[model samples]
Target: MFAIERLNKIKELLLAQKRVDVYELSEKFSVTEVTIRRDLDKLEQKGFLVKTYGGAVLNDKLNSLPNASSGDTEQKFVEEKRMIGKIAAQMIEDGEAVFLSAGSTCLEIARNIKGKKITVLTNDLAIGLELKDAPGVKTIVIGGDLIPLSTMLVGGFALQMLKGIYVNKAFLGVKGAQLDSGYTVSHYEEAMILQEVARISSEIIIVADYSKFNVKGFARLGDLTMAKKVITNTQLPNEYKKYYFEQAVKLFTTFDFR
Candidate 1:
């Protein structure tokens, strides 16, 4: 594997498991101990992790904030997320009604949605707050019990509120996206709300970084078939590309821009 890909795997491993052993990673990636140490040093310098005795851990600053905080999650995959957000935002037209889901990736899309005359509906409080001040963009929040971690409304109330409204596009984020488990979320309440959003939208676009792929979460929201398009960073594997394509879901990656 390429050095960049190996480094990303190490990051993902640290994020998922809070800690990683250098020897284990060295064996997994088929790299020498010296090379692994060099990789760890590089990641530490980038502020993505902290070097431990025999491994590395995710930076504490990145872990301290709630997952709902766009500021925190934005630091995880800066460039790739921005590129995906830009492309997803481009798919939206001036007058379209769009639903921005609650997550870091959706927040990025909200940031770039300026100057568009569009009706925006979301269950994400952060997205509402960000777009509330933008002129000519009507923002609607689906009211329900607020979940602080994701800053999203959940429960039957939020689902009931979205019963009849159909959006041109719905941009969603996933905790995990796998071939077997499909799109999943770590929390059950959030999954319920996302399921409703998926059902009501005319087209669903899942905005996720490549790290989300191959991971399985606690709750399964829906399959790739539910989404009309999957927008992610270029690091998505060829296996995923083939799987999504065979499932008839259009997969769009940001590398196309470069």
Candidate 2:
């Protein structure tokens, strides 16, 4: 129980959980909250995490993170996305048609769609591939030209195909979210596709991780009014929880699944 040993163990926990509360860490290590704060300060100085009011969130840049509209999705918030996806995938029921919009978080949902009797439609090439061979799951890739680096198909063909379906549920991944600005994205085409999906769906769900809460994007996708539910990680800021609640947007986090 040397300080060095405790610090290293805290780092390990932060790596796994992505965030750690000072109170929980204090109890876990049989140390005072003051001691845990000092440890967090040490870790923060080492560029491991960014200290919040009561805890530390892992510093993810390409590896500590946020470009607002979009960045390399695969590289950011790996564990957080996995947990968010797990919760979202559970909402999909048997004999339902669900739309999973493009993004790494949606790809995680596609991965967990196994053992379900459902039809999934998506413009995300990665998500389509992930569910390509899933048993009892029918996957339809919206046809169009692929967008560079993003691996998404969007445009006239994608829209034309979207016109024919009545989706029971639609899950979209956004670049950022803010109470004033709503969910936003970097590209107009992405916004168009998302809007069309939302229009044709019975229920709309926005899937994002904790980092997207305060961040703003270039294009607004509409206010929280459009999204009936938003799925994110437990690490989401409290201000956002209040915002979503006020907007009457149901928020589901990783804690629900755990």
TM-score of each: 0.72, 0.70
TM-score of 2: 0.70
lDDT of 2 by residue, 80-100 (tens): 788888888899999999999
Cα lDDT, all candidates = 0.81, 0.81
For all the candidates, what are their Cα RMSDs to the real structure?
7.8, 11.5
Which candidate gets the maximum TM-score versus the true structure?
1
Model 1, position 182, has a per-residue lDDT of 87
lDDT of 1 by residue, 1-258 (tens): 999989877776666445666776775677898999999999899887888777777788876746622344435566688788899989999999999988768888988887899999988898999998999899999999986434778888888899878999999998778887788875699898888887888889999889778776667898878887999977898899888888888888887765
State in Å the error of residue 255, model 2: 1.6
